[model samples]
Target: MDEMLSVRQLMKTYGKGCPACLDLTGPDHGRNMCPVCGTIVACADVSLDVYPGEVLGIVGESGSGKSTLVKTLYFDEEPTAGEFYLRSYEDGVPNLYDLSSRKKRWVRNHQMGMVYQNPHLGLRLDHSAGGNIAEKLLMAGNYHVGSIRERAVQLLEKTDIPITRMDDLPRYFSGGMQQRVQISKAMANNPPLLLLDEVTTGLDVSVQANVLDLIREIQRELGVSMIVVSHDFSVIRMLTNRTIVMKNGRIVEQGLTDQIMEDPQHAYTQLLINSLL
Candidate 1:
């Protein structure tokens, strides 16, 4: 099967870097900061492939760079070095990072969708629920007001948001409802790939279950490829077919979720699983 998304040697570093940055920082070195140059490596030499209809999970502790990897993929953060390819974009030939800003915006609006951990980042809380969805649609070049409204209704229904509350501002809704609205807006364009970053964090347990169920349902029904980043292993086990374990700005292990859960090869991965037990 063709990969829906491919990333190679993706690196994101903060501060002025030096030659020893890569050699001095990582799980092996027990840190991701270059003491010599005061550069922080957010992620380095990260690579992955997401096939059509696959849900790939990235799990790690705080500052593990899992979130940074996804943020770079969604274009919310720029990578210092990387090659990104999306099958829906020019048949995955040209590197997306090299594309012009206008073309990158087109790709972001038309070929991919992102649901941020913070609804504030994903939705314009000032806009009404339907209006937020319409904003995404507009960016994707859909202009018919009637059509936009109709699409919004469908998306809201799909995400389990009430059609009656279409005009309500997301800021006024409960946390769960706000996230639902963000999901609706993200899916408004029906993009081929979706990036979710710590999406269920900071929610009530029952509400988190409901939201996870909704996401699983959407993936099952739509067959949209997704990259889900979370520090929670249970979340990864529940929603992902494959998993990538990251540490100190580098991937330590990656494989089938079940296999990795049963037999983690890396010491860091084993430590993580033990914590869950």
Candidate 2:
């Protein structure tokens, strides 16, 4: 499979010029934050690739840079330094960071879909469910009301949300339903790249399973490339064929999910598996 997305030498840091911050540099830095300067290294030297139709998992504890990496890719956060390439964009040759802001926005609207951990971040609570999806479709230049409505209904039904409730605000729906609506909205444009960040967090186990199953179904049916970030091993194991384990702003290990599960080489990876056991 061709690489859908490639990231290299990605770094994100906060605070600058302090001696402590300057001193706190290197791949094996002890902490992500500078205790003396209070500078934070959210991510550093991260590199990875996601192939077309592949589900890539990023697993790590809180503050492990998993979320930061995805956020940068999604354009929700900017990286201090990096090279991002999306194959579908400019034939996957140009560095994304070099694109104009307007061009970047175009890429975000037409090529990538992001489902944030919080429904509020991804959905408009006050808008009707259909309206939320329509927003994305409109941003992508689909202006026909009938076509937008049809697309919204198709996505909602596929995500197990009733078409009857398309006019209802997501704020009125249950948490799981709201999440499903968000999923529907994210896929509103059928973007080539889908980003899921701690998507199943704060939901009940059964609800989480339903959402995960729905995600699996969507991925299988649509063949969209996805980057799923989470702290849970079960989520990663269930959804991704390849996994990257991160800790303290660095990638500790990466491999086929089964191999990582059966024979974790990194101490952090082993400790994570043992905790699960």
Candidate 3:
């Protein structure tokens, strides 16, 4: 399969060079902070390729740059230095980072979708569940009221949200249901890329399971490529065919899901697997 997305030498730092910045580029610098200059290195030379219809897992504890990577790809944050490419953009001929603001906005609306860990970031709580999905459709240039509503109903039903409650505001829904609504909205445009960051967090175990199952179903049905970001090994194991273990803004280990789970080469990856067992 062709690579759908490619990111190379990505870096996000809060401050300029300090003498310690160079030294803080190893596994030991998992904190990603420079003790001398107080620079926060959110990502450091990170590179990865995501293929069509593949669920690529990125696992790392908090402050390990997992969120930063997603935010950068979604244009929620900018990378200091990197090359970002998507097969859909100009036939993968141009580096997305070089695109103008207007063009980037077009890519965001038509080609990529992101479901943040916090539902508020992805949803308009005051809007009806159907309305939230309509907003995305509208942004993607769908203006027909009847078609938008029809699409909304289909998505809501797919996510297991009652079509009857389509008019209800997401705020009235439970956290898990709110997440389902968020997913429905994110998929409204049928973007090729989906970015999910700790999506199952802050929910009851059963609700988390349901949410994960819903995500799996959506991916399978839509065949969308996904970048699943989480610290949870189980989440990665269940959803991803291939996985990358990140630490200190760098990938410590990467391989097939089963191989990484069975024989983690990095001490950090081993520790993570052991804790889960």
List the lowest-lDDT window of 10 residues for candidate 1.
1-10
lDDT of each: 0.94, 0.91, 0.91
Poorest 10 consecutive residues by lDDT, candidate 3: 22-31
Q: How many clashing pairs per prediction, in order?
A: 0, 0, 0
TM-score of each: 0.99, 0.96, 0.97
Task: Give the per-residue lDDT of model 3 (tens digit) for 1-277.
Answer: 1689999899888888677774866577557888888888888889999999999999999988899999999999988889999998887879999999999899999998889899999999999999999999999999999999999999999999998899999998999999999899889999999999999989999999999999898888889999999999999999999999988888889999999999888899999999998
lDDT of 2 by residue, 41-116 (tens): 8888899999989999999999888998998897888889899999999789999988888988999999999988
Task: Report the error of model 3 at residue 175, Å.
Answer: 0.6
Error of 2 at 120 (Å): 0.2
Write candidate 1's Cα lDDT for 102-125 as tens digits.
999999999988998999999999
Which candidate has the highest lDDT of all? 1
- For candidate 1, list the clashing residue pairs, or say none: none
**Candidate 3 TM-score over all chains jointly:** 0.97
lDDT of 2: 0.91
Question: Ten consecutive residues with minimal summed lDDT in candidate 2?
Answer: 17-26
Backbone-clash count (model 3) = 0
User: 2 or 3, which is superior by TM-score?
Assistant: 3
